[model samples]
Target chain A: MRFKWSNVVLFFGYLFLYFPLICIVIYSFNESRFVSTWTGFSFKWYKALISDPIILRATVTSLKVAGVSATASVILGTMAAIIIARWGAFPGNTLFLGAITAPLVMPEVVMGLSLLMLFVGMESFFGWPSRSGNITVIIAHITLTLSYVTLLVQARLQDLDNSIEEAALDLGASPLKVFFVITLPMIAPAIVLGWLLAFVLSLDDVVIASFVAGPGSTTLPMIVFSSLRFGISPEINALATILMTILSIAVIMSAVFIYKDGNIKNM
Target chain B: MYRIEEIIISWFSELMKKIKGRHFLVAIPYGWVFVFFICPCLILIRISLAENLIASPPYTSLIEWISGYMLQIRINLGNYMVLFTDEMYIRGFATSILIAGTSTICCLLMGFPMAYAIARSSEKIRGILLMLVVLPFWTSFLIRVYAWIMLLSPCGFINNLLIRLNLIEAPLQLMNNSCAACIGIIYAYLPFMIFPLYSAIEKIDYTLMEAAYDLGSSPLKAFFSIVVPLAIPGIYAGSALVFVPAIGEFVIPELLGGAQTLTIGRLVWNEFFGNMSWPTAASLSIILLIFVVFPIVFAQRRREAKLSIVD
Candidate 1:
């Protein structure tokens, strides 16, 4: 009886979760301009996407920002993980930790506004950053994203055998050599997962980008927001479907890797 | 082992011998936070105190504390006074709080059952079920909103189907209102609610629940007395995650709420970029910041407490 009830609950649960997504995917091949009535299937939307210059430009810009932001975030995050998790943590460490984690919980509007205010202040107080632009956006992304890298790397760091570094040190290798040769390689997989997460988040982020991006800076979600004024577009369905595919795969894989230990006994 | 340790230690000591600026290791994250996050937040507090002017950005003097409280720009308490004095900002803030709170409660309501189901399912089935929940959110969010439009529209799917079934003669006007916005908000944030709850449910000891049953308690009592309290950590985490974002939410409300609805998030967006009232937007944002920063910062501290435990 208990099992039967759980099955029923699970059925409804899955239905609620997937209904809209499945609708969108089905409608991606949708022929009607009206997102509702299904006339017939066509690849026209996919084809139209190739020819749309604005979306194409936005896609490229998004890719560039994600790439740059992810790389920068990963490096800093790795350093943070190493310092805080692997090696010597400074005094009052958790406060520094709190500041790092603050961005994840900080409302998007607050983050964007605060960043804009900061840039404005910098321009006035020091005459540095004389004007606000992509530099500000990149900096904002870095501040937010680095924490993800740090958190992921820190989790990985805690599971690592510290004695490995000791062994390398005992073998006549210096701390720098031990880090590069031993610690870096061991945490490489986690670093990759962290980088991928940072990249995808950077791409999907609309709220922050809308506020701080430079002139003519059209990220994918930003364009999506502006075009939303026009109601639903078939091409958007195609774009969203693709992004969904990529992000899902990244999320699943990361969870699989990160959650490996929890399933160890079961496996 | 002793000889090997001696050799390894000496070689590592040689490598560290030349490296300087060990402090740089700590400097990067510290420097970035100070210049970017901490200082900027402090600066915003300062700017919020300033008076507004048209010609200049945030036009007003920096500090007019206890003595010069009347001057609008000279750190007068006017912005804050206006925040209290005007009902619009107050109402807007209230609306944001109410909507976000409702949405978070709704998430908990819908998500707990689903998460429990996922937790109790067979391993293979659980994987597939979990995938289904996450897969939709992975899709285009806007398109999903559009999907709701189709379902809720007068001539759309749900209406059409209902009419065809003779369930109702007239189609209900569903879209372009607060109700639609609520549906959309819940729809969008559902996955967030589910994931945290699911993970938490997975961690629960089934034996404990069974023990409650064996104690002759009713299933209802078992759920309320045993299952719910144990899941509080996940519930808190999920609500914080959902509520914080939902409070600042603009895209969903703007897209679905149509013309009738007004939200603090949309209000802020409109004030800055929409109305081009940059100073007002800045001041409003400062107000929004006060409300958001307090709960959100407090929540993170609580989260870190659990997080260290999880690790």
Candidate 2:
């Protein structure tokens, strides 16, 4: 029995999911500052957003944070994946896996506080790196995103056949050469996808950054959050529209890369 | 199956073959977590016993630390005890669980129909419906959540439309409240609930439903008897996935809870920043971790144990 209610119910569900965003997007173009009422449509808020120093600064800061944190996370995550995949369940393997992935499920408050505490310890112990701002933000971002990178890369690596590495070894290639030439090339798509994921996660994080970020390290989310102090602004819609474009591109890119990678071997 | 002796011998050889360069290359990942994730959390577990929140770090020793800063780390269970004694904190945790549980239930109720709809749709329509389910995630989560402030506010669309229809006399108090916050959480997290259930529902052979119909079962009975049982795993899977994070949800509550309600998430946030209670906050963090992780580990292990018996 093809339940005809399925299609009708689904239309309402789809509408529910998108109605709010559509309203906000539409009202962003409204001449009135108030989001509720839609007066005549105008491009004023969008124009004002272009000249807003604070919004621009926040966008720049968020980009930098996402860039730096995503980069570091990629390196750390790739390293973790290679190690875990190459070394079959070592002594600390189980514990290490748990620890790395634990950050994923850990409450943001828990992660934020603990990471801040860690930085405090680092400062006191090392007697340097005193300030907690961009560096700490990047570090914390890496700590959080590392798990995603590792999880993704590990998953991709699991599907790869071991015979390629075995063949390289059988040719009298050293471990370094084998990995650099064979494994690295093979897992390239995963690394790229992992980087993209890490970037997005770093961009999305709010709470952890709140704890670790010091003065002037306000990322985009931090800026949006602070902007809420004065209540909602339509310019927020302009900024949101831009960021949504960037994220959409990033997601589409990841999907393409993953799809290609999956089909690459078959082709 | 291969002979046990041969399998063990080959396993050792294969392991050795794979073990070539033992460089620090492999240590990087584990090492990072060991220091950042494990060490800091363990340090929190040590620091949680402080007498007060503001006793700045370098608590000297573990034993004294627990008892509060008494020239050193003196052991004290006061914080945990206070967590119990303090009505606000106890209430906060309870409320956090309540909000997360209620919203999770709501998510299931809303998500099941949508997921089933998507699963039951024509193959082509299913892809589009599924894409719609996932599309929200492509946008900024915060922005989507912020949309609610506009939707649920006094003059927000929901209230405005309802009033225009003469459904209510005045706008309901919708924004910056618990109910609104739950709505945001459910909406922000609906995609998460839908996909897992979708995958689970998609796995159930349609023939099962067809078989039930052929047996003269009503559609309702077919759902209850055949569909529901097959979907229980998905239900549990999606519920756990959604509920676990909802418990720790911060931004929605912060933006939406206004000042009246305090969740465990906001409580922990204030403990670190607002109250300047680093030790207490750290302790609270450890406690929260313990509470969530302990049950999860036990449940996961029990699942595996039961699965092993089936083999």
True contacts kept of each: 0.58, 0.74
Q: For model 1, how does the per-residue alpha-carbon lDDT over B1-311 read when each residue is reduced to its tens digit?
A: 99999999999998678556556878888788778878767766766666676654645657445565754335556766876678877777877788788888988999998898788888877776776786676555666676776577666667777887899889888778877888888888888988888887898898988998898989989988878877877888788778877888887788877775677788878877765555566667677766677766677687788779879
- Give the docking tier of candidate 1: medium
Runs of candidate 2 with Cα error greater than 4 angstroms are A1-3, A260-267, B1-21, B53-73, B125-128, B298-302
Candidate with top DockQ is 2
Give the least accurate 10-residue stretch of model 2 chain A, judged by summed lDDT. A258-267
Each prediction's number of clashing residue pairs: 8, 12
- Cα displacement (angstroms), candidate 1, residue B302, comes to 7.6
The per-residue C-alpha lDDT of model 2 at residue A231 equals 62
Q: Write the per-residue lDDT of candidate 2 for residues A32-73, one digit (tens) a residue.
A: 887556789799988998898887886787789989888888
Please give, for residues A1-267, the per-residue lDDT of candidate 1 as tens digits. 878888887777777667766666777888887654789999888889889999999898888888999999998898888888865557758778878877876767767877877887677778866433456667888887988888988888888889989988999998889989999987877788789878877877788888888676768888988876666677877776677777788777766765663532221
